[model samples]
Target: MSWTKKVLRINLTAGTCSPEPLNMEWVEQFLGQRGLATKYLTEEVPPTTDALSPENTMYMITGPLTGTMASTAGRYSVVTKSPLTGAVACSNSGGFFGNEMKCAGWDMVILEGKSPSPVYISINDDKAEILPADEIWGKSVWEADEWLHTKHQDPQLRVAAIGVSGEKGVLYSAIMNDLHRAAGRSGVGTVMGSKNVKAVVIRGSKGVDVQDPKAFFDATNAGKKILAENPVTGEGLPALGTQVLMNVINEMGAMPTNNWKDSVFEGASKISGEAMLEPRDSDGKANLTRNGACFACTIACQRVSTIDPEHFSVQNRDDLHPSYHANSGGLEYEAAWALGSDTGVDDIDALTYAQFVCNEQGLDPISLGSTIAAAMEMYEEGFITKEDTDGIELNFGNAEAMIKCTELVALGEGFGAELGQGSSRFCAKHGHPELSMTVRGQEFPAYDPRGIQGMGLGFATSNRGACHLRGYTVASEVLGIPIKTDPLETEGKAGLQIAFQNATAAFDSAGICIFTSFAWSLEDVAPQLNAACEGEWTPERLGEIGERIWNLERLYNDAAGQGASADKLPPRLTEEAVKTGPAAGKVNGLATMLPEYYAERGWSPEGDVTADTKARLGL
Candidate 1:
């Protein structure tokens, strides 16, 4: 079977490491990864428990397909209640960490109770221990990672560590693994920091054994063939590395610019994927050095990039890490948009520098940039001033200012301390709650939902707040991945959003990249899962599991006091229309779509999962 069928329970309060059998019944009901971990969260931690307190448990878990030959099987999730949203937080990351965890003879690592002092977890094979992290606690992710590798004397050790931002309790901080891959969003790292954890370093030599290796190989190989043949997964993503969408979304008039006051960005082309390939450095190298991939990924959409040393963000900045000058992970499309067009800054080098800081410091670039953008809008409106920003020019398109804010947030110092609270709290504290472009206290990503109608519903109703990954309707509404749908029309969007959300939940639970959905569906995913695990998997069954997962998370939110009422867009999105391009004069019709969405989901008119629906899904 794909599952290791064992879990490592670490009670930091007791400094004890124990192993327990996994709940096979729950695994069958929830599948794995996001779904399974969420099951643990809902059962162990109270919905109203303070997200940063010892009562809130953390699940660093892997799915069934993890550590196997399945495409994108390296996926892992950090599941806990979010300090940012006071709701469920499940942030996924792609790296070698998930595989290592599974190979270490554990399907999940349950971290509960707060440690008395700063510490880190080190696991090798079946042995695990908690050790003092005094030397690495306050360091950046890169510094801590280097120290861990050197001390352990294992260059191949997979380390997931939070940077200074996380250690100091930046609300939107992330856990960075394999240097740049992050379990990003919804303040999971803040939870880890609150628990007094600094890092998790693992080295595993055991291997996974599938139920039917031949069947698994065939199914996985066929899946990889689909990815390699698809245009979005094979050609566009590999060539442009998700930064492909900067120009495409901008051209479609869906790119959020200037904190989403504008749907079109004039500087979009200047900082696009094509521009990333253009040589602008004194060394005559493009900002993008090459494409990289997560463990077992065939598409290889990750960007390995370098910043120009002459750029003002890095020039004479000895305080900056050396990673700023060399090749490292670069900005993807979302980071580019949030740090670039959303803030009105088109300087690629500046964006690259800020992106490096985000990776090095383990910050969620989406919330970090969106927070600064909100602050910029407030400053320009005279709602806030130089006094609020500590005399810094919080203006749109000010690359230096943007970089400064990013660095501050990374280190949790100066004005950065205020910005690190995330856009929702930052704006509300400044007395302009309407300026925050967030839902459920989490910032929206690059898309301007005003242009894409389905995404509005998706964002408003997202279980983990305003995240595109919860239901990336952009794939269907804009790219026509499965079928073409009108991006402007609200009609039929409800069912579409439901379908995508259900399918996405399944993908997340299956231990594969959601990017695989650009080419694969539950129909394609079922075979691989069936071949790997001891189950008779089918698309319809997987879909039911997905729906169960979604409704379960919804039920958790309802108890957490963030359900239904939190499913709303900002005044700017529902009231203000786009100002230019094809979406000019258009606003999101969330009101029209939300009710239909609820009805399709078999929820009440108020958006509560009905008794019949819960019974049908066995929730």
Candidate 2:
């Protein structure tokens, strides 16, 4: 069997750790990672339990393919009930940590109950312990990582930890790992903080094994070749990172700018992937230093970028690590758009600074910056004044304010406390919920759903609130991956969203980066899975597994009281049309597409999974 077939259960309240065999029956039904974690959470924790209470459970899980040489197999998920949306939260991450967990001879780590004091979980092969984390309790992820490495005296140990934002109960706080990668979104980190758990460190040298080694190697090699040859996966992503989409989406007029007030940013190219490669006049060095990759990844799309030494964000900050002065993970399209364009701050270095702060402090830059942008708009409209902003000019295009707000939010300071609640709550608290451009209390990402119609449905119906990676129809709509669809039309979006959503769920559960899906589909994935595991894994079965995971999450959300009714876009998305763009006259046609989406999903018009459908899926 490919499975280690073991789970590590840690009870922080009791200060005890135990090992148990995984429920193989549930594994067969739910697959792994997001799916399996949800199954565990649903069975162990009540849906009605407060998301931050001791009763809520946090599951860190890896899929069957994790730790293997298969491309992008180093993925893991943090699954729990979300304080932000009051729904099932499953945030997936990619780094060295997931593979490390698998190499530690376990499939998952289930953390339950609250610790009386802050502690960090440490695992070395089969030995596991919860250590006092007094020194690093209030530290940033970067600080905690450094401390853990120095104290453990293990340079290879992988660490995943929350920052002060998480410790302070920031609703959109993320669990950051390997420095820049994050289990980002839905307040999973907040739940970790609530448990008084500061970090998880793993050092495992034991390698993963497959059922059929020869066949597994062949299949993975073939899949990698496909990724290496495809334009989006090969040329575009590796060359430009996701920042390649900055200019493309902006040209298509789908870029959400100035708090979604416009569908275009005039300065898009200045902060684009192409621009990152251009030499700056000050030092004659490009922003992007090089592209990096995770373990066993053939497609190296990660950006390593450097800020100008004289730039305001980095100036007079010698306490900052040398890596800040050199190069680290740079801005991707989403970060650039959310932190730069959306806030009307076109300064690339400022966005990079904000992104670095997010990575260091374990905050979701998308939600944090977008919420700040909403606050800025409210400030400009006189809905909120300088008094409300603590005398800071919370205005669009204010790079200083943007940087200040980012630091404040990261550290969970004064005005940051109010901003920590996220845009929906922040806006609602200030009497203008409509100004918050979000769906289900989660902030919207870079894409304007109005321009990309399929993404509209994807965002509104996403299981973990508004998230792009959940569906990401942009591959089909914008990049023409698999098949091209007219982005401005809603005609076939329902089926398209369902197709993408299901496929994405499978990708998430399989412990591979979804970025691999840019080139490889289930057809490519089935072979690797089939060769590695015990069962006959086919494309059809993978599709069903994806659907099963989707329905499972929906079932959990329904029981949590965030039913089909909660699957909705904010009023702005439905009522406000894109005033200027290729999709000039379009507002989201969610009304027309939603029922069609339900019918296509084999669910009721109200979005409930029907009995017949449940029976069909063995749910």
Candidate 3:
């Protein structure tokens, strides 16, 4: 069997840690990571439990392909009820943590109950303990990481931790790992903090083994070859990182700007990936430093960037980490858009500074920046005053305000507290919930739904919340991957969204980066999974597993009270027309698409997975 067939269960309330054999029956059906973890969660925790209560559980899981030589194999997921949306939350992340868990001979770690005092989990191979974490309780992720390494006296320990934002209960707080990558969105880190768990430090020298070594190697090697030869995976991503889409999307007039009041940014070129490579007049250096890779990923699409040393945001801050002075995970497209274009701030240096704060504070930059943008719009429209904003001019394109607000949100002080609650709560508090560019209490990503009809349906139906990664139709709508579809057309989009959503679920559960799907399909993934696990994992079987996992999460959300009513976008998206660009006079066709999408998925018109559908999937 591919699974070490083991799970580590930690009850911080009782201060007890135990290891149990994995359920082979579940493994045979659920696969792993997102799918298998959800099965465990659905079985153990009641769907109606408070997301932040001790009764709720968190699962950090890896798939069978994790820790292997498969392309983009280093991935893990944090699964829990989201404090932000009260929906089933599964935030996938990449770094060294998943590989470490696999190397430690465990497929998953289940955290239950609350710790009375601050604590951190330290796993050294088979030994796991909840150690006192008082020293790093209120520190930033960077600070906590350093303290953990010093306390452990091990340079190789991989640490995933929260920061001040999480400790302060920022509704979109993220769980940051490797100092940069994160299980970002839906307040997973807030839930972690509510449990008084500060960090998870792990070290493992052991490696993972699969069911069929030779077949595994062969399958993984072939998958890698496919990725290496694909244009999007091998060339575009490596050359420009995710930010490559900035200019393209902007040119298409689909880049959401100024809290979605506009569909295009006036300064898009200034913040595009191409702009990052241009030498700045200030120091004759480009903003982009280099590209990076997660553990074992041959395709290094991660951007490593540096703000101008003399920029106003970092000027005279000599005490900053050396990595900040140089380069780290830079502005991916989503971050750049949300923190840059969405806020009407095209200053790349300023956006980079905000990105750095998100990494350090463990906040979802998308939610944080989008909420701030909404506040900016509110301020400009006289809906809010200086008294509400602590005298800061919360105006669009105010780079200084953007930088200051990011710092305040990182510390969860002043207006930042309101912004920390996320756009849904922030906008509702000010009597302008319609202004919030969100769906199901989660902020929208870069794409303007009016410009890309498929994404509108995808965002509306996403199980967790409005998110791009849930079902990225931009690949087909914009990049012409697999097939080209008219971005403005509502027809055929229902089947498209369902297909993308199901395929993405499979990738998310497989312990590999979904970016690999730019080239590799389920057919490519099936061989590796079959070689690693004891099962007849064909491409068709993988597709079915994906559908089953999607239905399971939908059921959990339905029971959690986020039912069909939540499958919707804000009124602004459906009523307000895009005033300019190619999508001018166009509004999100959600009304026309939702019913069609439900029909295509075998879900009821109310968006519930039908009993017949469940029986068909054996869920």
Candidate 4:
């Protein structure tokens, strides 16, 4: 009853929009959102299809729980082949835009083929149209966002668009929505831009309905109560956001500093969550203004922030958007660590400004910062010169240089154009692929694998390239969620990584924020799905569904030429030992854990899913 049971298929090649019945069979097998979309993609698009070519397809979809009373139900995913990783890409985001699509009578929107001209798709309830985007074609997302709002005169419309980075094929470009929230990873936006489509705007009045409303309300309320009672969800997140991990990770010696040259950063505390609250000497204003939340999210981990107007980054710049003078919910732990510690820049305001530019221009800050750090190493080694960087001095601890590089990449010009190729391509082009701290051509996130042993395995085997979210062992290895594990030990970590990966896939498919997993498990989620969706869903079944989704993505990637052989950490993480902190003189034990991980997944010793696995999952 919660499902709209409808899909809107927009064929850009034909310039037509048509409605189709949702495939209930696939939904029954894969659930919804990320899982269901991946099922559709594998069935329709070939694994070897060029990611940015017209043969590829993109799906913007929501789950059955979306637009309902379920907390954090306003979630969606963009699923496609990634130009960055050349693997399966499913980037999830939180915002009202997802719920809006459900209200407009679509469970999923499939975008395929390339447009003859730049255009945008507009939807008002059931009415959908392809409209020329001539006036706003070359504009930034913010500029086009304003123009669309003015053109439609609909303040309530939800807009999801790409910036120049996406338009110009920055390899790690993102698709941003509701201004700050992003489906941010693996170049999904590059595929969107290659299709010559500018944006997707929608507005709807049809509210969602649920079967057994009383049970749905009761289950969701119980879920919310659990979140409110948990320390991580109720207190830590709402107060400091994910940035709370900055000091914690640094103290544990798990923070990647200077692009994994070390495991500890001296300036970690200066740019941490606590520091975000400290009043700056320049204007007596703190970097963080307050905390915010996505639609239906009680956790409220978003950081609404601002930069010092008098700071050199924004000083006397008139060619900037007025919004840049004030920033939005930016500078979370990943962005801060990537642009701050990894780049050796401790300037919190400068990091905030870089984060704002990332949000505005739809660039993946993790990849951007890691790439810049690699370039800094190259520069220090005399492998790169000032002439190669368009005259900007490339150095660690230089906030101005970091800010300049971020601006250039956002616009995809000059040296920024080179950096836009992502760390893998950029490093390889400079004849130093070893300098790139990446897995499967995608840059690693903030966590240093040498310090967080399970994360090393997690990063190595992630289906979407190097990412923390796919399997976050930190919850157990650090915060003691469900159970505490030793971060430095590699024993029993293969099982831990498998459990996290499978469970995370389920959460991503169920139209909920992965942060909710901090407090709730599949046992807690089963009741809500059982009540709102048409069929019964148990915790056991949900776990199996999660496994099915994982293997499904893996199978696709295998055919795409990214498989078990691709399970690897950068040499720096696997070979180089940390210099200080709890993990001093220790490197990640990836070699020991990888074989166990493969065995635990029921895959062959070579890491391929066995015939029995395919039969069990009915793939």
Candidate 1, residues 402-445: lDDT per residue as tens digits?
Answer: 99899899989989999999999998998989999999999999
How would you encode candidate 2's per-residue C-alpha lDDT over 476-550 as one tens digit per residue?
999888899999899999999999999998889888999999888899998898888877778889899999989
Please say which candidate is ahead in lDDT: 1 or 3: 1
What are the lDDT scores of the predictions, listed in order?
A: 0.93, 0.90, 0.90, 0.92
Off by over 4 Å in 3: none
Off by over 4 Å in 4: none
Q: Taking the tens digit of each residue's C-alpha lDDT, what string does model 3 give over 359-424?
A: 998999899889999999999999899999889999999999988889899989988887889988
**Residue 35, candidate 1: C-alpha displacement in angstroms:** 0.3
Q: Candidate 2 — which residues are off by over 4 angstroms?
A: none
C-alpha root-mean-square deviation, each candidate: 0.8, 1.0, 1.0, 0.9
Lowest lDDT 10-residue stretch of candidate 2: 320-329
TM-score on alpha carbons, each prediction: 0.99, 0.99, 0.99, 0.99
